[model samples]
Target chain A: MDEMTIIFSAFLNGMGIVFTVPVFSAMMIGIVAGMIVGLIPGLGGLVAHILLIPFALQLGDPLAAIAMLLGVYAVTSQTDSIPAVMLGVPGTAAALATSLDGYPMAKRGEAGRALSASYFASIFGTLVATVIFILFLPLLRALVTKFSSPEFFMMVVLGLVMAASLSGRSQARGLLMAGLGLILSTVGQAPGTGDPRFIGPFLYLWEGVPIIPVLLGLFGVPEIIDLAARNRSIATSAPVKKVSGLWLGMVDCVKDWWLILRCSVIGVVTGFIPGLGGTVAEWMCYANAVASDKDKDSFGKGNVRGIIAPETGTAAHLPGAVIPTVAFGVPGNPPMAVLLGVFVILGVRPGQEMLTYKLDETFMMVNVITVGNIIAAALCLVFQKYLVKLCYVRASLMVPFILAAMVIGAGFSRLSLGDIAFFAGAGIAGYVFKHLDWPRVPLVMGLILGGIAEPYFFASIDRYGISWLYARPIVLVLEVMIIFMLFSTPIKAFAARLWKSGVRSEGSKHGDNT
Target chain B: MAITPENNLQPVDRNQSIAFGRRVDWIVSMIILIIGIAFIIMLQSLPGRATIFPWFITISIVFITATYVYGKYRNKAVWDELYDPDTKDGDEMADTGPAFVLAHRRGVLISLGSFLLVVAMTMVLGPEYAVPLFVFGSLLARKENWILAVLSGIGLWVIIHFVFGDMMRINVPVGFLFGGFN
Candidate 1:
């Protein structure tokens, strides 16, 4: 009858799959599996995405496939924060920022409430972002199509500047780290020249360093070192109290609405943008929320807001990423791209009929997301208290298992020794980087986005010739951002300071930003 | 640059250790820089195909790291921790044990040992054999309680053997130790 009715109808139709027996079971299975994966460290989105393929193919129904896949993908960020808040270890890249406050909250006996905040923020963020995505799907698609290499290059420049600007300390070193990341990203395969760089016996090096391994080594290894260094001074705080009210926790979401809202928008926008993905959004939002907070002292030690930022950002991506995927058939994120493969295998076209809302197919797509979220969230609400207890396990008990799992997870992903070796090598390098006062996040981010940027930068060059860089306004804008970052007073100072401090300095503010 | 105690590296022996540790620190970082440079050089030597990004990155990184190493520390920050254990905190927090003893805890060594074991196993038996074996073995080795270790070991075995291997149709290589039995 009207646009509201059409939207409501779409929501209901999309949710109708919950009534089907197979879809219901699939939803539960997906959510539970996602939660488990999210609880374990080093098993990230990439691993989960890989794991979903075989199971997704088995499901066969495009609707069921979408439901299960999205359900698992959606809840991962939420469940991941459980471990982060309680254990001081993150299960995914996005949840990493959560550990800053989450673990601190646990140590302060607010683990339950903090965990509660994470789940609520995620659900609220996803729903709000999803609605916005559906409402603006048409306009967003048209806008993205206007983008060419110049726009993408500008976006990368923007992403680097934003990341640098947001890092908050030692601008010079932060800019240097970002530049180093971009430069390193250019390794292995020169995007413009197709020339290979420092590849060795490690053929995988040809693709540049594996970001996952680096992430594991830099963040995960350093954390392990901290735990080992602080062995006896383990948390003396009382365990978090579990109350009988899900509604109470849900209201906590209302108190921090602005924070969650900002993180959600941040997550959705970054997730929707090609290549920038959840990790950057999570870290940026987490840091921003902390910087903006009046109670900043409780941040890295533990706070509710810290836990919420990254969790909300990551989950918001469920809906945020779906816009580009469903409307344009251009997968905005890795998980969405893999999910598209399942859609293809199931003989369903992603964008054709879904946007118009004419076919039941669009309904099926929505059904999958809604069904999955409901099942996962419902279970989590029921078990939040018990799940929060997992945070108290001693690092000694967890370290061995974590190491085994990381090695196994990395090894299993590609079914190769090379991956494990690469992972270990990355971990050592990461450890060394920490000691040497080098920033590692930019290095990993650069590698992840480098491969993608290369082909596009090259294609654009070949298509319009080298003049294309100057021809486009967007490219010119990006050029300005890059130059601004390089020469900024704060940036130059940080780099010089970092070089001055070297490994024996107080980790100088220079390396801490990103 | 002010050398706040927090910036110091741990695990350096005290006494004559400062000079020796300084030498070790320089050597270790220098060796890493060299390896990185050599990696770049190897990539450069590869025949007429496109792939210069990796080498360029390695070279630049090595150069930067070498420069950082050359200028940063007058001496290794080893004794900085042992003598001044309350390094970072302006407040005095007494150690329950020696600093190095604490750093060399079972949790630390087991994890490091697991990494080396996996690398060695992978070299000897290949990845397929190494992944599951290492997974089960490391968990079994690191956990103090036998029951938990056994359960975790079996749990890991079932998942790797059944879920990943049988159902998912992924092939894990046979270990050299088990080649004769299977």
Candidate 2:
């Protein structure tokens, strides 16, 4: 067949698979299930993906199974904003940025507007990202091949630096926490030699720290503790008299189309890079929004743009994250990593063949992202009135329930008592960090990226020796980016001072002329 | 004394809070420096490749902590900038009133103590018993109505039993006294 004919045929076949009764129905079920799971704080798409793996295997049909899993994966970002906006609690790490402005808006009785804006922004982001995915599918092979161990290591370093610099008020504190996280990540056996480094006596440390329990402790527990301490409902203002701003929220998204587009691009780019997922994407977009706007103070103070930026970025990130997994078997994020495993179990080889003969399967994923997000957003919009009421529940009543749910979620990570102990420790530390102004996100980014980084660093040195640092073109480019990222704040501050002095001198000269 | 939305309580003397914050920072930084130094010492025994990353990170931690401490001491303005109360995004600092401060401390202690107590209770009594007890006790301690607290506890137990126990089929720990769920 000619290339055009093959493309047309693959597209039709993909649509056929999606429209099939079993696949479509399975996807719908997964979408609903994912929305429910996303509403629960700390239980993210990663856990849901793990739980559904066995069921996906039992289903016995590749297309149906893929549809189901992808359905779950794509929609979690849509509904995770619920708890983030209604309460100060993020349903997932990706929703953290949403809570910055979202909860404040809720406090001001605009919960309906915030929730609606989030859902619409997410839907638009997914649609835009799906289009980008399709348009760039042909170039994925070329793009992924350009990266090697040296480049990958640089990317990881860049991610860590960016996260550390952007988070919290003090860049130094963020870097310190990130460094601590990196050291903690080295607790397990070394990647190259398999020799235990810092396990000490506890066998649990040999596997290093599990991310989920630590995440629950770091983010979830501190919020719960604070809520309990405050002794009030999440929103301190009078009860919302009306939940009628859903349409207005959608209107806000439309009004901010340019911002959404820029954020979506940021999302897609970050999501395309391995190890830099929704968390990083959302933060970068939030930072970008703050940087570009004249009214920077409005952010974290109930700015609608803040909610729109992160929501759009994370939503676009879903499809961008899937591209590498489909093309080169390199998963973009943790959930996509799980999806890659599902692909292997279903006897799908991800490579050139996925682009050629198995193209239909890839397109099926695109369909899932498109259709799944629409369904999820529609459902959330319809039921958001009831969802917003969760903000009004007394903290005394909500705290224990949330704590129990968090414990149960952490327990599910390993089904071990050690994890619970670790969770408590992390919670205490998290509370302390929260009390102080240290950023917790960089620490998390460090822990996650450290394990991936070490192996790549070793591989680069082993294969290319020390010259890999300066020899590789991509590595050099990335090194420059990292340097710029590290020094950008100081550089910007100095430039601003210089500009003010120049302006002052110019005004003095004009006065002399006068 | 007037209340503010951000502070949520009558304003306290700013200088006093900054002093307290600086003391807290000193303690925290010193602890981190000590831990980093200890880790660096420990990494000395590991093999070359194994120690490389940890050594770099621990040294960085120590360096950063030292720089932070030194910077704060040399310039009080840096401390002021870093410890600005108004810059806080989420939860604000507790009021500095003596009674409110005591209540805040109590709240922190209670929160931490409850978490540890529940974990300890679970180890002995299993999640089935521990979860309901924690919920009921915390709600009642918060002075919630007795009937509502009891119902809330029961409602949580039912969810745990049905959803987690039955639907998910998680092998929930049965506590040391019970030996096992079996």
Candidate 3:
């Protein structure tokens, strides 16, 4: 079939999912489930996606499973924007940057506006990303093929360098955190050599550092401190009325089209990268927004664009991840990979034979993006108001529940007392970093990327010789991009600059009185 | 006690030598470089194909140490804020009330302290015990509502049991204390 035919058929498949078979109802269910799951502290998208996997499997077809999973996936991120905004806790790293602005916005009685803007922006960003991904699939397919080990190694190095440079007060502190992360990741038996660095006698540590608990510590614990330090009265402010307005939200979105579009693109592109996930995408884009804005002071002070960047960056990752799944058969995220495993078990592959010969696989791929995006949008439009009410649920009332969940999630993740210590340690480091105006994301990012990079680095160098990097053009391009990341301000910095200019018009009130 | 913001940084005990802490930083870097270089030397002594990381990391550490040395020539107050509590940026945001100042300071302490508490609690409680205990205690530390704390604890327990035990099948141990009564 021609490219136009594929697009037409995909567009039709999207329409089928959107209008027929109660897409609205599924989205409504998804919105509620997502909000509840996101508020559960450490669980976030991984848990929600894991729980939905069995159900998606029961549907027994690539498209149905994907549609259902996408419904869950899309709303998970949008809802995550909530607790982070109103309560200062985040569902995942994706919501980390959101809390910087969203929580402050909530304290200022614009919680409704913050939630509403993110909800719409999420839908908008996902749609825009979907369009871009669909158009760019062939190019993306061509791009991933050019990545050899040396290039991959170089890419990892660049990300590590950029992460250290962009993060913390100095490169020393950033590298130290990264070094610490590398040590923590080395706890389990080595992936290649089976040498466990620091597991001691515990079998739990034998598998290595647990992702979820580290997540709870890095993101969850600091929020707990913030909540505890604030007196109980911050939660009991008189509720802001006059929040309901569909038309007003639509108008607000129109004015911010450029922002929503740019951030969505950033999120999708980052998602397309193999190891860099939604968390990095959201943060990088949020920072990008701050960097590009002329009004630099408005970012953490409650700019709607700040909230939108992460929510959209993350939401778009659903479709963005789907690209890798359909194009290369590799899952781009933790939970999505689990679902993708089920797909392979049920007989799905993305090799040349699948794309060139298997019409059904191609159809399934198209439906995944177009159909899934609509399902997510319908859910957002219908249930955004109730999710906003969560912002008003008295931050005091929500704290006890969230705090309890965070500890449980951390404790249960590793099945060892040591894991808690790690979480606590990371949290302590996080607190000190925050107070000192240091960035904690680099530490987490280092751990995430470091664990994956070392093995790849050793193997690639041995197989291809040192010169293997120049042989792979895609790898060369990535290496160049990393160089840019090293020298330049992050995409987030640009976004922040643009955001500052917008807020200068509203006046940089320098942190709200509320 | 309050001088102009510019002079607020004048001589805590007089002398720029205090900022030489960066030299300690450089010395630490040098030591790391030496240790790494020694490892490479030992590897070359052994029957192996000489790896790249030791040299790579050692050189990088050396470079950072050199940067630290270069940074040390003057302006000690700028590089080493960790040792100097006398610095003004600690608790002084404009227009923030006394309550905010206190909360912000305590926020720093709580964040730092919670990290330690988790380590201690884990040592005594193990994961299953530690998870619930820490969850409850952390919640209890906030907002002073015991009822919500209990409910959240129950909720956390159920979810962890489901996610870790049933779904992911990652093992979590029960310590000999608390629920270890099993």
Candidate 4:
């Protein structure tokens, strides 16, 4: 078939799948669940994704399952702002920037305006990201055809390096966790030889450590522990009496179309990088907003642009993050790492297959993001006042319920008692890691990619011997990219210093001239 | 950084917390180094091809961890910056009052203990009994009202029984005492 015809057909097929009863219904459920989770401080889409994985697996339809998860992923940036605006407690890490200006607005009784502006900005951001994603698909399709085992191996390495370097201030620590993850992935039987490496008398280890339990333990338990320790409601303030200026907020977003577009683009670019995720995107956009504005001092004091920039950027980031995940199986962020795991479980291979045979499914995911965001924004607009109450639900009330869900979710992974034990162990480790400022994302990326990396490593070696390192053009290119990514931070820092010095010199010279 | 209400830690407490965190980091790095060494030792038993990747990873772990430890030791500024609250972004520095710290430590223990207890309970009494009991016990322990705890427990039971048991048809364990239901 012609490219255009294939694209059109895939688009239709994607819409058809999305509109199906099971998929559409599940998406709605996911959207609502995401909103609830997003409103609750400390519990974000990652937790929701981990908790729902077992259920999504049970649903038995990949499209429905993924659509449901994507629904959760897409709308979080919208509802997470609710808590950020109302209570100054960001519901998710990405909402931290939103809370900066959002809380000030709420304190000024423009909570409705800030929220509605965020909602609309998020909607526009997702729409812009979707367009960018669509435009990139053709180019990605062309690029993915050149990938092979050696290239794939290097791609995974590049992803790990990028994640490790960018995830935390300490690249060495991040790499250590990643190395540990790779080692852990070796627990199962060796790929070709079928000999167990670290089974240690446990029969279940033959399949390797289950992803679900580990994910829950690593991400979910730590947050729950922290919340329980804090031992209070998420919101200390009374819920807003009535939300007003929502229309004004929407109008403001419309008037600030250029800002929304610019920030959305920033978000997409940031999102395309492996470890630079929604938090970075939002903050960068917020900084940009502050820098470009004439009355920068007015920011952090109820500036609407502050709300618009971050929200748009963060909303745009989700789809941008999905691109590398869909095209290369390299997750753009931690949550995408979990989503990529689900995609694997659903019998979907990312990379070339996603671009070729499974293009329709990719389009389906895009559609879910688009439709999910629209529904989420509408729901938030209508239920703004009611949703604010979720922020006030006591952590004491939430902990047990979330704990129950975690236990059940972990157990369902393998129907094994061993999984729960693993979960508990991982949770403890995760809590420590969180407190110690260790980056967890690289570890997750390493764990998920480890299984895939090993086989590709062996395959490349077997097929081309060590010459595969230099034999393939793409592999060589990837090697350079990996090295560059490892040192990008220092390079950027050096350049920034140079730029600052140059600017300072120019200013001094100008003063002398005056 | 976002001006959340949670950023209320006193400067002294925050500095102390950072010190404590640095100590923990040192301890964790040492533990990782030891583990990596042990793994390298363990990799000796595997066949050549099977051991290749593990050996690479194990050695990488050892090398990377050693480098991290050495770098931190050699560089005081970097070491300080590693746990410096001012250098960090995203999550606020955790409150580190003595009482809150103790409570936090207790909370971590309870969280882990409760999970393990649930697992043990699941093995002995089955999820049907274990889940509700856990919800009830946890809620009450957390000082929630008894009526609400009971209702929450009951509500959880209905969901587990209906959603997971009947609808999904997961073969939930029926308890060792009651004759395990697989």
Candidate 5:
């Protein structure tokens, strides 16, 4: 009864933050802005978080500031599918899998249906993930305590191994890009030794490369280039059709409630795995949909199941990501890392103490995530009917506006000529990678993991030595998972061949018996 | 069994572009290898513990690049078999031909040219002025309506200035050339 009271009060405290006029207004602004950002290819929540933090800090109330930023972060996953459905350009990495079916649906003039399904699944997934997060609070310590330095290092390795799965068919390219990203992470001044490894003459290198510009260059620029090159509107064949089937789309989401549940489970579980992040969650869920569904071949070809699976996974991972962050002070992704930085700026330390003494804040975070998800989904649904018309806007006209936004957005990170130059370079690199068929997401995953991985790896080695590091229960579990993931592709292939041979043998035996 | 270029990336004439396009992958591999070697060399000055992770990374990069290059030579058939199919389907705008240059050469030049123009302007006139110039110039370059382009340019500048500069108090750089503005 005492525990239940604590839970109830915490929930009320969170709701109080949302109801406060200033915080609620800020959240509304964030939700709307985040939706706009998510509609633009290559501008994701990270960009929004980076752009808004300086402003959020000035907002006076700490809870409000967090609410606003969390509002933005929560909405981004929900709306990133807008562009993926409309133009086949995912606004974020998590939306990449959504484009597989969403874009095809748009091409077929079913944009309204696809968008509606995404919004419904997104809200459903967020609600479910939040409930799971709240219910799992009691088990948090037991689950998180098993993770130490060595375990973190293994998790980083698992992230890299899992990158191969994202390659689709080009596993080698994915691994290579992961290596490249890891290498890029080591470019700045070494944390322990204070040795400037690659700064050269640029003082900016001391802090390492700013991720925003790099991301913009890698993801945003390529899309812009593609848009301009096409020299036409995004939707060629599809007219600005009425959102007639939107109701049916929502019905379809409910009909496929099992899929949403399963993918949400996939997302929440994968979210707990350090370094796997949203991209992996969405991709794994997407792969699951393709593998398990009866109409497997229809994926990447306007299947509503494809759209729902990724959108659900994207939303489900948010609470999962928040769990590790508030409980362990370890971020699940780059934006979450930025959020951790905000925690420090606000003079708050996140960890076990936060879970105990600061239960109200934790609950506020949970409620904010839940409320933010609802508001974002509602806003998208209201505007999607009109926003779907953006597909008819000429690429030439839209490209300039997006480019301006990208430039301004990238500039928010740092005001340096080097930053712009770095973006240009990254843009060139992005184009090359896109052309060469290299898996770009692995590179990004590597970049995200590298900074966190290094210190943990060195600390584990120094404290436990390599042999003992491998012996820890959690580390051993992670190792086994990594090894299995590494070989799972080949194992599945072999099994399929075995099944085929078995069928042939059975047929021969039946013929002989006859 | 030589690596057949992905159909989407292939030029209109495969035989004509293969000579140039096929070399792109090898060249990229060599460049990555050189970068790895350079990093390894740079790490030589660092303390041993600080250098360990970097060293591991650089060596891995070299090993991977070498293996990729060797496979290109020795197991061309595997490369041929493993190459991903063109999944773009009918998306005409998908990255095709030389992704760097792109099919519409003029469009690439205009977009990149306008980007450089914006950077150059920002250095002289600051983001406040440069943003409008970039928006208008790029829109004009795309041959859009003058009134619409101007309105958009001015509107975006207002949003960025008021929101970022005035409200958020983020320092938008005052150009060194504009001494009075600073």
Candidate 6:
């Protein structure tokens, strides 16, 4: 079939497949459940994904299974902003940047506005990504294949650089946290030689520290401690403004339409880079917002534009992430890796043939994503006014509930005594980091990317040697881009000044002539 | 650096703040440097390719941390300029009151004790009994109402039993108190 014909037919078939009772119902359930999971601090889509694995395996219909799973995945980044905005605790690492400005806004009684902005920005980002996905489908092979080990290395490097930029106060602390993360990633068995480094006596260490428990420890436990310390509700003020201020938040996003677009592009590009994933996407977008804005001081302090940038980045990356997963059979992120396993269980192979012959299935997944996000966004908008009240509950009352969630969340990793032990240890470390004013985000980025990057670094060294690795055109291009990114701020500042001077000179000349 | 509310640390004369900041920085950096060195030593003992990546990371860590400590020691201005918040001594620095017990030493001991009590109880009594006790103890320590605290404790245990133990089929650890009694 011709490309256009195939696209048309597949999209039509996909609509039929997803709109059915079983599929749509499953999708709705997944969306609602995912939102709940995502709203809870430190519990995110991965937990939801794991919980629904039984359903994914038991369901007979492929479309329904995919719809359910993809629905959960799509909504997580959207709803995860709740805890972020309300408590200054991110539900997931992807939502970390959201909390930068979001929590501040909530403190100022603008929780409604933040939620509304997140909802609108998420929808806009998802829609833009969907369009980008469809337009880029035919070109995905070339796009994905261009990134090999060297390029991947460069991308990881770029992520680390971005993490350093996120160091709100001190580059030293940010770099320190990031370095610690890299060290932590080396805990498991060696990538090449199968030699264990830091497992000690525990067999669990063979797989390295699980990201969930660590994240929960790092972000979740600290918030609980803060709550305990403050001895009050999340919102410090009484008489939080009437909650239906979503329209104002939505208007805020509309005002920063350019920021949304730029951040969405960042999301898409970061998503295309295989190992960087959503964690990096939002941070990079946040960094860009901080870099570009004249009033940089307002960021990390209740700026609506801060919320818009990260939310858009978080939402836009989903479809972009799937492109490489579909076209190259390489999972773009961890959740995508899980979805790839689901695909295999459903008797669908993902490679060039799957991209071509199973175009219908691919489109079905895409449609699920698009529809799922819209539904999630709408539902969030509908319920967020009520949900915003969570900010008002006394921390004393909330602690038991949150503590239960935290303990259970730790157990979700392995259901062993060790998981709790590790969580406590990591929790203490997280507390220390937060206490020391260390930027915690880079530590996480380092942990995630270190595992991916180390293997590529070794492989590139062993196979092609250092010179050949650097000689690759793509590697060279990415390195140049990294350098450019490093200096772009000063370059832009200089250009701005030049333009102003030129304009002033032109005006002066015009005055003389007159 | 611009001081925001997040960095609610009181501003003093720049020199005093710088000295305070440097003292904390030196301690943290030294600790990190020690950790890095320890890791490097540990990795050095590992065999073959396992040593390679870990060694690289530990060395980088050592370099960064050492540099941080040395810089702070040599120039207090750098430390002051980088100072954002002092989370390390957050409890001591926090506003003190009856409600803010967690910021006090007594409250901290209670909180830490409750956590340890939970761990010990879980090992002896399993999650069903231990979790609620821990929750109740913690809430009560935080000065919550007794009835509400006890009720919340029970409610939390029930949820854990039903949700995780039953629905998710997680193997809730049977404790020594059970003595292998199923």
> What is the DockQ ranking, best to worst?
4, 5, 2, 6, 1, 3
**Model 5 stretches with alpha carbons more than 4 Å out:** A1-23, A40-118, A164-168, A237-260, A267-314, A317-369, A465-467, A486-514, B1-21, B80-106, B123-125, B155-163, B174-182
Highest DockQ model number? 4
lDDT of 4 by residue, A206-249 (tens): 98878898999998888887777666666777755656888999
Which candidate, 3 or 5, has the higher lDDT?
Answer: 5
Better of 4 and 5 by TM-score: 4
The DockQ score of candidate 6 comes to 0.27
Candidate 1 per-residue C-alpha lDDT over B68-165 given as tens digits, one digit per residue, 9 for 90 to 100: 56444532353234234343222112111223333354544655665677766765665445555665664555456767766766676777678767
| Interface DockQ of each model | 0.20, 0.35, 0.19, 0.41, 0.36, 0.27
- How much native contact recovery, as a fraction, does model 4 achieve? 0.45
Please give, as one word, the docking class of candidate 2. Answer: acceptable
lDDT of 2 by residue, A1-514 (tens): 7655666677678878888999998898788777755453334565565445445555668889889989999888887787787766675678889999998898888888988899899988987887776667656645556777777677778767766876666777778877877877788889998999777887777778866667678766766665666666434444444445688889999999998999888888887775577888999999988998999999999998999999999999988877766765556765775566456446676656677667888888877887898888898878765654645567677678767766766665556667677788888877777667776767776776677678877898799999998988888998998899778876886799799999999999999999
Please, what are the lDDT tens digits per residue for candidate 3 over residues B1-182? 12123223447431342333344455544554564455445435322232344345445545654554565445465566543434323222111122232325655465446556655665566554555666677667754578867776676666657866678665665555655424
| Most TM-score-accurate candidate | 4
User: RMSD, each candidate, Å?
Assistant: 9.2, 7.0, 10.3, 4.4, 6.2, 8.8
lDDT of 1 at A366: 49
Q: Each model's TM-score?
A: 0.64, 0.74, 0.63, 0.91, 0.78, 0.69
Docking class of 4: acceptable
Give lDDT tens digits, candidate 6, residues B5-100.
323544443334445445666776777788788787777678866777777778878887777677666766445655423332222222221112
Which residue window of length 10 is worst by lDDT in model 2 chain A? Answer: A233-242
Error of 3 at A354 (Å): 12
| Stretches of model 2 off by over 4 angstroms after superposition | A1-121, A235-263, A266-370, A493-514, B1-4, B7-13, B89-106, B143-169, B174-182
* Quality class of the docking in candidate 6, CAPRI style: acceptable
Ranking by lDDT: 4, 2, 5, 6, 1, 3
In model 4, which residue pairs have backbone atoms overlapping below 3 Å? none
Instruction: Enumerate residue pairs that collide in model 6.
Output: A435-B87, A435-B88
- TM-score, chain B, each candidate: 0.52, 0.71, 0.55, 0.71, 0.73, 0.63
